[model samples]
Target chain A: MWRRRQDPDRAAPEAALGAILAAVLAILALIGPAPAWAAETAAAKEPAGAAPAEPMHVIVGYLGQEEVPRQPLSFLEPELQDEGVQGARLGIADTNTTGRFLNQRFDLVEAVIPRNTDPAVAIAAQMQALADKGVRLLVADLPAERLVQALDQPAAGGMLVLNARAPDDNLRNEACRPNLLHTIPSRRMLADALAQYLVWKRWTRWMLVAGRYPEDLAYAEALRRAARKFGAKIVEQKSWTFEEGNRRADSGHTTVQSLVPTMTQGADHDVLVVADERDIFGEYLPFRTAEPRLVAGTQGLVPTNWSRVHEQWGATQLHSRFEKLAGRWMTPRDHAAWVAVRAVGEAATRTRSADPEQLSRFITGPDFTLAAFKGQALSFRPWDGQLRQPVLLAGPRMLVSVSPQDGFLHRVTTLDTLGDDQSDSRCTRQ
Target chain B: MGRMRAGLAVALGVLTILPGGGAAAYSVYVSNERSNTVAVVDPETLTVSKTIPVGRRPRGITFSHDYKHLYVCVGDDDRVDVIDTASGTVVDSLPSGPDPELFVLHPQKPVLYIANEDDNMVTVVDTQTRRVLGEIQVGVEPEGMGISPDGTVLVNTSETTNMAHFIDTTSLQITDNVLVDSRPRVAQFTPDGRHVWVSSEIGGTVSVIDMQTRQVVHKIGFEVRGVPKEAIQAVGIELTADGSTAFVALGPSNRVAEVDQKTYAVRRYHLVGQRVWNLALSPDGKRLYTTNGVSNDVSVIDVAAGKVIKSLPVGDSPWGVAVKP
Candidate 1:
């Protein structure tokens, strides 16, 4: 269910202030003139020598779907408690910590649509309500299609939305919106991060195994492009046709043990790269591969936006704080949501404005820099509104490396090497 | 046997004479973050003379007012280890609140202001008594500490909060808070103390804040040809005694920007080791030292020539650098 007011205690003071203001205005009208009491009240509102501190209000809306129970293939990976919402909540709290000193207050409103409802219609209505409430900033955790629908809504015309979940590259390319900024790393970026590390390690030969899902194929396609860009060779490509078995079943291990070995029998490459975006059977292929090759891409040694094991560059503090708040490890989705909310906070703090247009301009401008605990400053690309950041290459227990590797340089920034650069961007947003 | 005894006497005489010699005998102390040790480097030879074991995760290092002790921030231990300069051993520990990453000592007073990154507060301690005096609430994740030359105002830069809080020394109250760019890592006041130079590690710029106006009067940016803009993260800043030139450590870019302080223009860039985080100037102001985190070495730069004269391998992940005159 949508938790309309995530924090009611925070809203009480503002509501009380509004009530007092209304009462004062009513009294002034009843007096019908600039009476002595009204004058005294006005003077009392202003301190003798100090100016009245008026806190700036910035409301950010979170749009996503109601959580549905997921049956994870492995018991080691439990269901997330709040996923994107918790990260947004943490972001709001972090912003408020800074906001207290800056005379600014950050608030987040949540709108979670049920699974049965049509997301497009529900999102349009939600956007209308948010717009009515003067909310111009949003963190959209929806898929690409629904996000586009939300963006196209007339109520959202003046809003600045941060895409926190969807990694669809088309959203940054052909379907790019001028008002939309993407915080999530695209598939190509993730693929290129892995490819660069593999190339640096001299593991240039890859055996690709793609699942049957379209998303899986899309990931495979991105990996192919990355391999070509980074001078890697895909020795062979095969599609996985085995049905996913229940991990809790008694015969599951037997099936996985035989299936994975046969599926990876022909690959004699340096690494076995799997593209199972749907999480069908990638986990089973890690240790049961035919050869003694290392596993990468989507599982095994993965390139991610965030990892629980990464502790370098002051990320240990972030990891501990998130664990304290969420009571669980921070996922990549949570990191994206945190980045999105921090972006708005950073923009408002720097530009000293609550206007959506001004904040948008500042975030896209050259002067804006976001310290996202990524060991570098992250900024959005003007052409596509994709936030440029270094991708972390991590194993299950430790951080292996960070990409946009040393030799992989770009004309603007090394971060531009991870994703679609400006010259390659097809986005026409002005 | 007589010749060998004569040689040993000559070596002992040379060692005694070196300590009495002027600035050439000064030692540069570097804190190795991962190795939990401090490497004492000889500036003249550009080599580590001795390695002293320290507390866990030693990051920021500074000398006491009298230069008798070196205070090192052991972030994991939540205390500052006081090292006796004469013996190069941990003599005592100061109860610096939680996760103290950086600290500054007042020029005239015996008070030490430590930035507790996890606590979001500045812990003030009496350097003489090693007792906690008070803690002033500041912005989140404070990582940088600086004090005015006159010791009237204390400045702390919070990395996540993105603000520099100015605290009045007498009252220990925050008088003003100025917003800087993202992740400001180091703050240093010029010799004259008219302006405070804050380096924003993630912002890739240096903000020079006027002391009187409490406003950023100038922001110095860097542009290295063939280097990515994001890689040019400005971290440590050091100004010469004459205030004519400033050296800035560009993190991950493997270079130090030499800027003309009067013109605020980058005069040249001296190549250094990987992921240079902090810098220290020699006693004579002729040699500048940079702690390279990734390369596990220190690069000694010649101030007049603006070149890295030599790179000496130190401990693992050397982060903070200080010089004992």
Candidate 2:
């Protein structure tokens, strides 16, 4: 230690300094092993982030190809299905580019089922093949029951099944499996988020329009639950069928008006919330509402995984990467698939190894977190497979606003208030 | 520079000034990179007192000029969180630029220079006001900044550009650009302020820059047969008072290389815990504290013998190390 003797109070070290040096060495020599009684677990120590190491492999398992045989009971048209699959492919490529730093490798593989055939068998076979190929993580964008049947294999213990397509609330809540994760927020979650936002905005009264389909009814039921939860009232309810389409011509506007009620119904609600999860007849209600009520569901105000018109703080980068890779923009389903893989990757980083049990625990742990394009950090629901995240509530042209505007005070953002939080959640058996 | 610990460890002197036995005197600080928690430990008793939680992603911690406050740059949280030495609580978060990764405090003033990795800027914050007094543009991902002994010149390490920007302290402008290895980080000056050793993680070596000449005098590579220079990924480097020896932590290889500062040669390559990222030597220069990132362990080495005496498990992805001993 040098003191240039420029300062008035400066002086050389006395004999006490020499004694300190001798004591310091003596302390270093008296070392001991760690007593393994830490306050926090090693895995949950850091904020959840994907590991820098590359994944073992990426397996994109399709159910089966149409070239095989006859078609299934229900599916979107071939062009629509192709569009969805195209969305998935682009998402895979986008993840690869974004995660290129970690040397994350990706592969897109597919299989198709025949007419009237059960998609479950083919999906299970593909999942088994995925296991053999050392892919312990998966992204399945299939329907509800079929996805469940596909993941029913006992050997699928190590594989993390991510539901990319299925939006059935049961998949995220009651029927949620150990390794099975859901990227698609449940319909209940979306409805709750929207209802919370509406309630916060003081749009308390609702003009409810229910659809004929089961999924539609389920969505309506979810909205009803939300209305009850958030002190909103459903003032009126209306149901319609796909009727008199060809009969109503341009010249017969009077006839169409007579059949569909041109005058005011007995509705005293502020918002006309349509619960048509399917694109059946609710598409016609937006511009056709008699009174000036806010149309939702199929049009106007809609809650989805991700929207194309979204151009927020970090959306452009994700959208650009997705388009450049797959040569097309990502769909809502594609975003779900991507989030699933990223979640698994983050779990691997936390646990430091690809043990399924450890990764599962790491994810469900209280500290498990993953940052998405939603501009906030989200964690998983320990009781269920649901990833409690902000639902992107949007309109046709632009995003009106994100929900959970009030009462949500996360370390990051208030949007986290939309989805199922720990207290109001019913997933106790997970 | 092990003996550099003897002179620059002003915090350890404060601890030794207390009336305590030999075993309970030294204080150990573990910088948890991800959790942003600094674990304070009593080295002799091996007892962790409290995990002082700070801002988001706290890394690169150092005591103040008078060794009163432990200044930690909370990276993602965009603040230089200050810890009150006596209470060890985060009393204040210094307003900083986005992603303040590493920092250097001026020895005589209240100015704290924070390296903003994202915006490629060096924000000079008035620590007392916790306000940004001045800012200057630097290269991409400015990871480290160092101040001269007299506090006249400031050297900023631009990680991507692999160069050190020497700034005139009073003017706060870049006066010189001294090019070093690829991914130059942790630009630390020698104890006597004669030379600056810039650690290049990917280059697998430390470049010694002569301050007076403002040029790299020599590039010292870690000598090993099977280990490539890239594998070394030398991150954090420290030196002794006489500038006789220096220790460089190789992140990829999980080892520390002790190099002869004058000869520009590695004296010994000591095996440490897994993925050693940073280091801190005891005040008496007898013990060395290392943050093993991957293994989440801290390797306490006997500096005189140059061997690991204890490997204490800390938090997940442990990174920075500061010793009060």
Candidate 3:
């Protein structure tokens, strides 16, 4: 019913505070008795169906793989087998909570490919099978290559795929696909979120340390781009060549304590920025930096899609609900998957349709916004199909801040300042 | 000009400190979520006259029907702290369900309808007997409680469920469930009880639902220049007694929108403080008070003047506001 209007004219600036405390003594003189709670009355209860109707079933397919789990650097941070799927499950529950009133029932059909198999072949067969089940909506938790292969299937051309796992920037840029929408925050977005906060805090000099993996290098490249974009200077860059050890071993701290300071000794920088996406050495960089410099990016203070410590914007309730359902803290992948499933739910609820075409159009349309517990309404970019949302800069046990920071303004939404902007985007698809 | 403004401030300050002999004096209570305290603001002086210490994470606040006791939702403590208005201290506590967020009172009865965020149910408590009458199951994360003017129909909105549920008072049954936008924070019924305006914090729109038909008649959107649409989140809504004008708190945009009630059009925006979370109107409806979460302050707006008069610093993370005459 509401329509967008032309932007209102700007108003005058704010005025100053002039009033002072006049009478401090007059505040505490009054006293009154509390009310007596004596009267009691019984009320009868009757159960009635709020909305009684035959529910329409909407099926959503989840395509993922049972990947060989990698042990995390810390014992507290365990690699979850049901990470992405748990979130999708929670999303289905949440969707059905709203869908019940609308007479729309949502069912998630999960097909996780077995380990040590050809992912493309498995994805193709799974896509065909899901398509046969009349499941047009899909939440893909696959990696970049597998996700692309899954969507490249002939049957997937009609299916709307929500990419929930891949954080690779290429998927949101040169390799962007019209049918595939990404809910995961790209590497560039994560880097830019941290960069904005660092620049806002006036920590402009960065000591960049990266691992040898391709994902690490890609994240490091994004950090470099963010530094250039946000007016920060990368004072020095280093490659970590140390082999990982048993994370829970008692001797691990001594080695980390010695090697980290040695690797970070002589950089005249304000912060040590780590790009160890494989979780090799980033967690050890903090408190062991050469000059008491703050460590961020991938560890210490991390720019992430979601964190366990984030409780703002009514996220505490969400976090509580997820913990009750998943029995673990939600990771970034879980949050993305949840948003992906919830986006479908939101689109379905708004459009009142289960048709994949209608839901996809409504989701990518200008008016479609997902309230994903981020204090902002998140929506996908028309140019790149990337979800634009505020990235949380989180410490290990608490949320530090969220970016785009206060003054980083954008022509469109401020969330566009984090990732590939319209002008910087390489994707031509709308 | 600076000297003249100082002189006027001193004169206004002196006038407020004196006891009101004939004219009615009102006290504005602001719940500081982070501070776990309530700021007792003097409406006349536009200053925090007293600070009442309460339980942890106090959020939703309101006065009893007789305006003698103030009920503050202490979420961490899982109870409602009752503050004696005259003494400015917490004197008693009520057994509210776990993580009580927001609540409402029946117009002509000593009954409290509380939104228990953790339980996904509305806990109905008898105010006079301090006993929970019943718990009505609603959608997930139930908040935004509203009772009709005639105190017959009760409405509760669930943040995640995105539905404003209409409940029958006598039978305690859900009569109708009207789906609105995402994260509906507050449901404010028009004084005449013809419609209910529900503010969706993440949806960035206020859904105006016709009470008779239980359908959304209109959706009101707000826009302010130099501010992003995400920041212009619709949160708390305050409608005038005559229902001619409605003021909506735009969260994180630091603005309050003046809207035309009949047309469902945003008239203009008055810049307030950062993350305006909720609103309260003075008894006379001539002034509006907004609790700004991030800034830890309260912005006072002169309703008829269409401008913010002052920003008074309060405790940390001011979440809710209530006014007592």
Query: Tens digits of per-residue lDDT for model 1 on A282-367?
Result: 78888898887889988889888999878877887777778888998888888999999999998777766566656665565555
Q: How many pairs of residues in model 1 come into backbone collision?
A: 0
Ranked by lDDT, top first: 3, 1, 2
The TM-scores, chain A only, for the candidates as listed are 0.87, 0.74, 0.87
The DockQ scores of all candidates, in the order shown, are 0.21, 0.02, 0.22
Which ranges of candidate 3 are over 4 A from the true structure?
A: A1-51, B1-24
Per-residue C-alpha lDDT of model 3 across residues B84-126, encoded as one tens digit per residue:
9979899999999999999999999989999999888999999
Task: Write down the worst ten-residue block by lDDT for model 2 chain B.
Answer: B6-15
The residue-by-residue lDDT of candidate 2 on B1-325, one tens digit each, is: 2433332322322323334335454577887977769998777645567789887778878787666788888877878888987798988778879878788889899889988876668999998877788998876567878888889989898754446778888988776666555567788888788888888765566777788777667777775443422246788887766667788898757789888877877778888888788888776666678889878888877666677767877787787777764
Model 1 B-chain TM: 0.92
- Top candidate on DockQ is 3
The C-alpha RMSD in Å for every predicted model, in order, reads 11.1, 20.4, 12.1
lDDT of 2 by residue, A167-211 (tens): 887676667666666778888778877887787778999888787
Clashes of 3: 1
List the lowest-lDDT window of 10 residues for candidate 1 chain A. Answer: A11-20
- Model 2 has an lDDT value of 0.65
TM-score of 1: 0.88
